[model samples]
Structure formats: C-alpha cells, structure tokens
Target: MELRRITYENVDAVTSMSVRDEQQNFVAPNVASLAEAYVCVDNGYAVKAFALYEGDEPVGFVMLGLGYMGWSAPPCAEGSYCIVRFMIDQRYQGRGLGKKGMEACLEYLREKPLGSADKVWLSYEPENTAARELYHKLGFIENGEMCGEETAAVRDL
Candidate 1:
C-alpha cells in the first residue's frame, strides 16, 4: 500500500471515494477535505492530503494538518500534527486496508513531511467504536479532549 499525493490525475478518483452508508457521518467527504486543504494553504497553514493506493487503485484518503492551530476545540499544543480526515472507500472495506492506510499516514507524519511535530492527533465521533478501537490499538490515547463533538486522541511521534 502507498500514499500518493492527490494530483489532478487522481483527484477524481479520490473525490469519488466514499465510506459505507452507516459510516457516512463519521468522516467528511474527500471533496470537502480538499476544500479545507485549499483554505488552509491560503491561510498559511500546512496540510497534506493523499490518496491511499494499492497497485495504482485508489482505495482511501487521508488529510493531515501540520503545526496547525485553528481548531475551535482546545487546539493541539504547538508542534503537533493532526489527522484531519481519513476514510476507506466503501468497496475497500474489510480488506485490512484501513489499518494499512493509517500506518502509512503515521509513517508519513513521522517523517515530518510538512514540518516538525512530536505527536500526531485525531478525533472520531464518540460512538464510532471501530475507529476508537483501531486508534487505540495503534497507540493513540484519549486525553479527555473534544474536537467539536468528537473525541480527540493523540500518540507520540
């Protein structure tokens, strides 16, 4: 599995990806995330949005915020990176790609691709047990913080 930048050539495929109906509320759509990426860039913040691929097939998407401090919820401490958005296409569910994709994201973040950071953060809907479990298994711990209505978690980089 590999994470590729969402270029014009793959933007269509990435934006068309969707999660299962039941999970629709858990993540923002790729297009919206792309829009946010644009806004972040315009506002001088760093962000990375990528399409998760397996042998050239787009199966998921991830967006990362680097050293960003614009959250309405208590912002992450300085020098923190956040997983702003993530999703596996409905067709790719149950294939173990979600874990691989997340690992890929973490790997990319560990490189400090956009900037320096000591931790990676993410949030999920309070009821999204699958996400909570996966994140915990991957070493993220909830710090009793909230990002909007979601529960926030963080892991050392």
Candidate 2:
C-alpha cells in the first residue's frame, strides 16, 4: 500500500464511499469540487490529505489538520497539532488497516518537529465502540471526560 496526495480522480472514491466510512465525515460535494476546496494545499493550514492505495486501487483516506501547542487546545495555529479524519474502506474495516492507517498518520505527525506539538488528538462518537476501542488499544488516552458522545482521545507523539 502507498499514501499519495488526494486528487480529483479520488474524490469519487471518497464521495461514493459506503456509509460506514461516510458516517465518520459528511462526505459531500463532488470529488472535483472538494479537491478544489480542500484546506490541505493551503501552505499555512498544516492540514494535509492523502489517499491510501493498495497497488493501483484507492482503498481509503485520511484528512488531518493542525491545532495549537496543547492537547485539545484551541485551534488557531499554523502547525501545532493535527485534528484528523481517518477512514478505511468498509470492506477492509475489520482488518488491521484502520489501526495501520492511523499509525501511518501518527508517524507522519511525529516527524513534523519537536515544538509544533507532540499530542495527537481525535474525536469520535461514543456509540462508535469499535473505533474507541481501536484507539484505546493503540494507546490513545481519553481526555478525562466525554464531550457529548463525541469524546476526545489523545496520544503523545
């Protein structure tokens, strides 16, 4: 598998993604328009997007954005933290790819720098037990309390 920049060709892969993937994010608009409007390419946003391909076929995706210098801190920085949108193809969900995908993203974040922020943050619906457990097993600690079922989890990078 390989990770590459998201492009118009992959937008359809994103938009038409199954509900299992779609429920994680409101995958709206056509691929072309979404690509055109993405924040990842903005030099100052510290937001990057990638399409994961197994050989030549796009299999999944991840969208990550930076925040401040604190864990779950306010989001007003150029490259302090990363708020992520991670997803895997429904067909590949139960496999280890989701964990692998998040790990890949974390590895990418860890290479950013020493001061940009070392805490990795992600939020998910409380009912999404699979993801919460996946994250917890991966060593992400819950941030003391739940935030409307959209509890926040963090890991030190």
Candidate 3:
C-alpha cells in the first residue's frame, strides 16, 4: 500500500472513509482531520494528510502534524511529530490495512522534512485496546500523558 498525499482527484474518496461502528469513538472522520490539517498549516506547522491506497483504491486516511510548536498545544517533546488522526474504512476493517497504513505513515515520517523528529506521539482512548496493542507492537510506550480523554504514547525514532 502507498500513502499518497490527499489530492483533488482522490479527496472525495478519502473523505468517505470511515471506521467500523465499534471503533468510531477511537478516531475522527477524515473530513474533520483534513480540516484540522488545514488549520495546522495556517499555524505554521507542517501537516501531512494522506490518502492510503492499495493500487488504485483508497483504503484509509492518515494525518500527521510535524513539530507542533504552538504555545498551548499538547506537550510534544521537541522535534516530535504526531499521528493526529488515522482510520480505515469500515468495509476495509479486519484486512490489516490499519497496520499497513501505520507502517507507511512511519516510513513517510522518517524521511527528511517530516522525519526530523526524535520521537512521535499518538494517543487513543484508554478503552481502545486494539489501538493500544497495535501501537505497543509498533514500539510505542505509554508516556503517562493524556490528550483529552485519551492516553498518550511515544515511540523513539
């Protein structure tokens, strides 16, 4: 799978992606994430919003905010990026796309302009065990922090 930048040609499909009912509370919709990305951009942060694709098909959306240096933003360690939002379409659930998409996100985050961070932060609702486990397997450890009602985790790059 490839994580391609969201573009006019595929924006519709990307915005249509949604998670399964049980997982809905774990993530926000793609449209909301895209809007937030724009806001981040206006604030001088480098935001990457991607449409995850399997060949020609859009499978999910992933958004990242690089070096969020805002004064009142969550306390991200210096030079850290955050996977602000990520989700697989409800129809695509159980196919391992989430894991694959996440791996792609990590790869994309590790390169130059976006990859200058020494760490990456992501958070999930404490009730979202699947997210917690997936992140743990990817080497993220609880940093004893919170993003609203979600517990935060960090992974060293």
Candidate 4:
C-alpha cells in the first residue's frame, strides 16, 4: 500500500473508511464538516497528509502535522515536530493497516532534517485505549493533557 494525498475527488474513498460506533463518537460535524483531513493537506502548515491506497483503492488515511517550536523541545526535538490522524474503513480493520499508516508517519519523521523540535504528538478520546496503546507501543507517552473528547501524547524524535 502507498500513502498519498487526498483530493476533493477522494472524499468518497476517505468517507468509505471503516469506523466503529465508539470511534465514530469521537468524530463529529460529520465527514463533510470535518476539516481535520482536508485542512491539513491543503495547508503547508502541516507536515504531510496522505491516504493509504492498496492498488487503486484507498483503505485508510492520516494527517501528520509538524508541531511548532517553543518550550516544547522535550516533547519533540527542537526545530520541527509532528502529530497525525488516522482511520481505516471498518471492513478494512484487523488487517494491521493502523500499523502501516503509523509506520509511514514514523518514517516521514525519521526522514526529516534532525532538529530539537523533531517529534510527533497525537490525541485520542480518553476512552480509546486501543488507540492509546497502539500509540504507546509506537513510542508515544501520555502528556497528561486532555481536551474536549480526547487526551494528548507525545513521542520524541
């Protein structure tokens, strides 16, 4: 599979992603109003945003944002930082696609020019332990901060 940018033409593929009722609970304003994916990809402010495509099919996606510089070095490295949003179509789950999407995010980070601000952060609903755990195993640590429907975590690069 390859991770590529999502276009207005790909909303169908993106909305086609699998999401559980509980997971859906975390996403709101419906797919149309959720600019989480659209905004990041269109704005250069984000690191990179892409869709995971298997052949000609898009099975999942993520939006990786480079964190800003400041007193946030320990959370990141020092110059550039990052975060991501990911999802797979419900019918596409259990095939380890989450790992694939995350691996791309990590690889994207690894390939960046080294700096103190080089790291990635992510947030998930406090009740979403599965996502929290996957992020943990991938090297994220809880930042002890929670907002709205989610809590935050960070991984130093």
Error of 4 at 39 (Å): 4.7
For candidate 1, write residues 1-157 as lDDT tens digits: 8899788899999989988788989998999999988888888888878899988899999988877545564466457888988888999887888898899899888898888779988999999988998899899999988888999998998
Quick one: best lDDT, which candidate? 1
Q: Please, what is the TM-score per model? A: 0.95, 0.72, 0.91, 0.73
Candidate that would win on TM-score? 1
lDDT of all predictions, in order shown?
0.86, 0.62, 0.82, 0.64
Badly placed stretches (over 4 Å) of model 3 are: 69-73
Better of 1 and 4 by lDDT: 1
| lDDT tens per residue, model 3, 96-143 | 887888998888778845656778998899999888888998999998
C-alpha lDDT (0 to 100) for residue 13 of candidate 4? 71
Off by over 4 Å in 2: 21-44, 68-80, 113-115, 145-149
lDDT per residue for candidate 4 within 17-111, as digits (tens), equals: 65787788654422642365456446544445567776787887765555542213333322445554577777777787777767776776676
Ranking by TM-score: 1, 3, 4, 2
* Lowest-sum lDDT 10-residue window in model 4: 69-78
Off by over 4 Å in 1: none
Order the candidates by lDDT, highest first — what do you get?
Answer: 1, 3, 4, 2
- Candidate 2 local lDDT, residue 95: 70
Instruction: Count backbone clashes in candidate 4.
Output: 13
